[model samples]
Target chain A: MLKNFADKPLVIGVTALNAIDSPGPGVAVIRALRDGFGDNIRVIGLSYESLEPGVYLHDLVDKTYQIPYPSAGAHALVDRLQYIHGIEHLDVIIPNFDAELYNFIKVSAQLRIMGIHTFLPTHEQLDARDKMNLSKFGEKYKLHVPEAITIYKADELRKAADELDYPLVVKGKYYEAFVCQTLEQAHKAFYQLSAKWGTPIIVQKFMKGTEINIAALGDGEGDCISIIPMRKLYITDKGKAWAGITIEDADLLDLARQFTKATNWRGGFELEIMRDADGKLFIMEVNPRFPAWIYLTAGAGQNQPEALVKLAMGEKVEAFSEYQVGKMFIRYAWDHITDVSEFQQLSAFGEL
Target chain B: MKLKKNIATSENGFIFNPSTGDSFSSNGIAAEILGLMKLGRSADDIKQHILNTYDVEPSQLDRDWEDWSMQLKDANLTEL
Candidate 1:
């Protein structure tokens, strides 16, 4: 059982504080955590870059510390967390970046031994949902997924494109995807994406449909605690949702339940789904963490982050049955002005 | 020949299809037609109501009625 936080607030550490054009879930997750716990939680911002907006958002984050990149390996990551835990006595740590989750999950046991708890998916669950293995996962679970061909060289793009046919999607192993209507466009995307995200470019069959997303949380025992389905009203050039509304769709909710049951998912996750003209649902991508729009789950009355914290603390949480439908979230940007001294303090001392 | 059972419409011409999570805004006439449909009115009754309320000719209403029904079908708002 977890200790009562009546005297001292629950100090939670969060990573991926970047709230740029392609926003990270950190800032939004922090907002949801505040909404959930009220004044009973203290947020410690774990940042990778000095310019991450959450570092300077003193209202949201009590203090900020710069963590090493994931390439520095799990040992370096655990060392930094140990230092942070020594000061903040972090009760829970939520790593929000796709690139950083592997390192975090790798060191979760060690962190637990040091008194910092985390609710994250197991390594096998993470590996199964990886983009490279999504097709196999879909096949094993009988889910509809777009066919994809993973290739290592640029010359292989033509063959993969031919197999999938024209108007395919060229995607990097990790990020960046472009829809190519011709072989020339495919070749160009191949070179650009491979140069940036490295080898094993994925050529997926373009499945045209209306896009829908679901933000869900599972209780690590194959039980879905909360599920909120949303449809994008407006999209940005980068394909991120600018405006979205909570929707009432049983099928979407059932899909999330099926995923949680199959994977026994233990944490927050996002499902990028596509509904075809005939109303067939296709699982396009499975994000292993909370989406940037996760704050909507709290607005819709689920408070998933709070539930996740409870689960991490070994508390039993009941599954949330209903959420307010038509609750909409419209994202807007405001320039957060801060002096260079704050940046210098964080950059020079690695803490602010 | 009626709107879906769970489809909700507001007085301000907003339509919400709960089944598909698609929302749409309609003009005054279209909203009136949807309101009538929500009341379990048949197609003929909807047309008659439109004729009684608006100053549209029967031939023009017939032409536009087909187009309007097609629009509802395309939007997946109607249970045909």
Candidate 2:
């Protein structure tokens, strides 16, 4: 470590590099960080799979390390992280995967001992937005949420199906959803998704309406740093936004601020919203981390991830007051051809 | 088993089936298997070749082959 430096470079670790059909926010977050700090920061890419392209993007990620999958449990994760920290000496880690956030939060204190910082919502704040607790959260915070219930068993789905009208959504606890208009479709989707993502699937009232999304950042002290709302212009089969345009809506901003104030939420969050025919916004799901569309925040003016870094560093950052609306983002696939030996190396050695 | 005809596959592992108009991406090994399948290699031949080329044991390779074949069947890229 350098003794007397006016400004030492910041080394930040980021996860969630899977940007395929079901996108993750790591690429977007890294882009936002690059936009903010440029050459002043070194990005340490943390990946679960060997093929996450972010690991190979030399311009974006300064270094990459393959970490144990979250299913490997906390001990293995911490060991790998400890080894990586010994080498890279990260100043902060921004975990972008929903499955991995809990593990990061658990080890945050250990990380702090190593001089690494992370700004994240408390465990209670995270629990409040869970699929099982969505209704409770909305009820407690005076927000509108569609009727939903988590089914612990397949038989429970039948009961939920009887209550929620036909064409209701059968959703896994974490990911995957299907709209079932009949008992047969409901049962099939329930069984299939349960096999994939596990039990306790959510049976939600499927509202026929426009889907809107808000990506916002909240300080731990009941203050929202930035809020950017977008409406999907084009959606793929995976339900991801291929093209979206930012919109200026005070009501949406107010909802974000109110929610953050209610939960005292810290860090980046994306609120999945459904707007009905009457223009009423209902919160569908509250993602605890930044959304895959988070890069749009950087383009619009407020680099939320950069602000999050400052907050994590214990530096005070003022809330962003202005943004350029109507800015659009259209996602595309770009292919990078590497040698077969490169693939062999990464798969065999666990690093690129 | 045979790979679907008119399936456009690139070296970078992007696969586009012109018939079904469905596109998918494969990993390096999957791409190699698909390429070999496109060349009309039999499953046993490909399995033997992989066994010789990679360090995986036969039983593990067999299991992986079965799973990969199932995935290819699900994707409608293979006809058995």
Candidate 3:
């Protein structure tokens, strides 16, 4: 049973409409929403660029509106959203991009005042899971995390690498990572990442293991609503999961619960895990939003986005107890044929 | 000749190892062997059943059984 306002379809706005090789979760989340609400929900696509594939996928997205980039600051973002809300009367706005989440969180109260609700992590929760602060978070929660050292300068990388040893991982502040086996490669990675994503490069100890991912939803009260662990069956060169299978892992579920309990994680989150040969699970990273492959959770019987919507609406929701063990999701790319006129309409008018 | 106690198999050759959370699909011969293993059939009993049911030389069956057993072991579907 889905809820609608005054017998009208629930208008929900979603961002990160890019569904490419390295995709965002917007499309998948929208699919789950459609599955849950069917004709009862109206989707408004929020895009930073006009060319995002979701903008042209008219069948899935009812309307498209161009939003300002996160660099425009929270005030500009709220101003844009206020304009969109005036027309669309959005009931919920799910900001899916990591880069834009800070602004969304900042303007969440303002959005609420305009009658738009969002389920997102708090500022403290978001900061605790930041790439640079993961080690400290892990230590505070008493969870296993690989040793990592943050270096602001390339010269500092040598000492960090020496501490972590060779064949370590060099990571940028926000994104990009390289597994460097030698100091030379580490320096190259440090310079390259710093050039693109800025300094304070993170050099981490390399843990040899099978990588597993857990997509989870929390109720903002230290309660885990759903958790689905997946093992990547295939990976792209960019380290994105091309194909994955849902798995049953008690330890992985326990880790998700522990993280939720410790952080009181509000919205959807993903835990990048490394299970070593000795069966030790380490917290590799914590993404503060639903992952691109979030549809797999619905396939496995959780329907996390739907649950998240209910949570966002302040409805009483129950925790999901179990899910199918062997469900799999294989992602593929398809060419969407669309007239350039639709692109021009969105670009010129800022709405389509 | 023994599958793990918690290993679940379907007639269509889908096998699930709950302990490791790994799933696999097998060909007809492998599925047959897995079914026999689940039924607690001994190695000789499984070999005899395969020889009686399928058209294969005993030596070829022996080699294939060894390979299949190794695969099952590697997948952690069979108890040592």
All candidates: TM-score? 0.97, 0.79, 0.92
Model 3 per-residue lDDT tens digits across residues A6-58? 58888999998999888999999999999888888899999999889999988
10 residues in a row with least lDDT, candidate 1 chain A: A1-10
Backbone steric clashes in candidate 2, count = 0
Rank ordering of all candidates by lDDT, starting from the highest = 1, 3, 2
What's the residue-level lDDT of A47 in candidate 3? 97
Instruction: List the pairs of residues colliding in candidate 2.
Output: none
lDDT of each: 0.91, 0.86, 0.90
Predict model 1's lDDT versus the native. 0.91
i-RMSD values for every candidate model: 1.6, 15.1, 2.2
List candidate 3 stretches off by more than 4 Å.
A1-6, B10-27, B42-70
Give the top-scoring candidate (TM-score). Answer: 1
Every candidate's TM-score, chain A alone:
0.98, 0.96, 0.97
Using TM-score, rank the candidates from best to worst: 1, 3, 2
Q: What is the RMSD, in Å, between candidate 2 and the native fold over all Cα?
A: 18.7
Residue-by-residue lDDT tens digits, candidate 2, B1-80: 78877666887799865323356988998889888988989999999999999999999998998898888788767755
Q: Which digits, one per residue and each the tens of the lDDT, describe model 1 over residues A81-176?
A: 899899999999999988899999999999999998999999999999988899999999999999998898888988898789989999887777
Better of 2 and 3 by DockQ: 3
Q: Write the per-residue lDDT of candidate 3 for residues B14-70, one digit (tens) a residue.
A: 998754557888887777777888889899998999899989999999998889878
